[model samples]
Target: MRILLVEDNQALAEGLSTILRGSGYAVDAVADGASAEAVAAAEAYDLVILDLNLPEMDGLDVLRAMRARANKAAVMILTARGTPEERVKGLDLGADDYMIKPFDISEFEARIRVLLRRQAGLRSSIVNYGGVTFDLNSRTFSSQGVTLDLPAREVALLELLFLRAGKVVSKDAIMASLTGFDDDLSANAIEQYVSRLRRRLAPHGLTVKTARGIGYYLETTAPTA
Candidate 1:
């Protein structure tokens, strides 16, 4: 999953980014509301962590603008603004969830999982596909009750494919989901990652098929026609 973090505090932003990335999410963070708005509008993300207090633009205005532009990424307001009126206004302006500052990391991560699951229209945190089961909370993959040991990048790639199960995911989209803004990955590298993932899933009868010049997709079943 990809996330855009908009927070003015450098320490907090870095800490949150580390935690998110450690959990297999590609995160891009901006310390100001203006940058956040620009970045949010330009890129695609599974979620946006927005702080109401921002420089250059108010967090609420950023949220308003994103909604105006039809950016459908789920937005979670994380700030010191704990008043009931503020929360209502943020929700009224299109914030998906509101979280107060001085929060527990566990609760914050749980809320994130909920928002992401809700956005994807999934009722459970465990996703099963083609004999492989993925635990969204633990970021682990298991097949027939046996855990699959895989590298972090491979795990992230597999999660992306599993989430989009029956659809063709473009290489560009894959690149975006696997990398942060400052990271650069060549097409060759993407192919290498996919190839590795393919080998790992082969035992489970899960195949990653290329769409020729486009990208790749996980084939749950072979075509009979």
Candidate 2:
């Protein structure tokens, strides 16, 4: 999932961004609330790690603006606000969760998992679409009750498609999800991956449908006449 981390501390921001990126999550970090607000407003992020004290605007103000603009991304306030009033204020401002500094990385990841699962209303680690099953934590995929041997990139593609099943996902979005910075990708390469996936998944009763000039969607099977 994509996340925007708003922390003014350089070291903290870099550390958190590294950890999230290493865990296969798309991460963007900003040291000030202005950049955070701009980035958050410009793009749709799955989560936001915000700090209370910012350079220009307060983190609470940022949260308020986000809510004002109707951005529903999960907001986790990461600050030194341990008092009841501070926490309550942040929560009242539409922050989904709160975390204090000096936090354990392991606990942070665990909380992130819980928050994401909670947001998705998914109690289980498994995501099922048609005959395709994915264990989100393990990064393993199975089809027709058998495991499928897929490259990491292919697996990423599958994850995106499965997550957005029954909805058309634009090719541009897919490219952005799969290709990180410093990686070059071509449109033809994406088509090739989709083609390969189609051939492999067809045997297991899953179809990745293309919408001509639009994008692609996942389905259980080809439509009947």
Number of the predicted model whose TM-score against the real structure is largest: 1
Off by over 4 Å in 1: 221-225
lDDT for 127 in candidate 1 is 93
Writing each residue's lDDT as its tens digit, candidate 1 over 161-218 gives 8889978999989999888898788999999999998777888868899999999999
lDDT of 1 at 184: 84
Q: Model 2, range 15-122, lDDT digits (tens) per residue?
A: 888888776677778888888889888877778899989999899999999999999889999998789999999999899999998788888998887776666668
Question: Model 2, residue 75: what's the lDDT?
Answer: 90
Instruction: Give all candidate RMSDs, comma-separated.
Output: 2.6, 3.4
The stretch of ten residues in a row with the least summed lDDT in candidate 2 is 176-185
Best by lDDT: 1
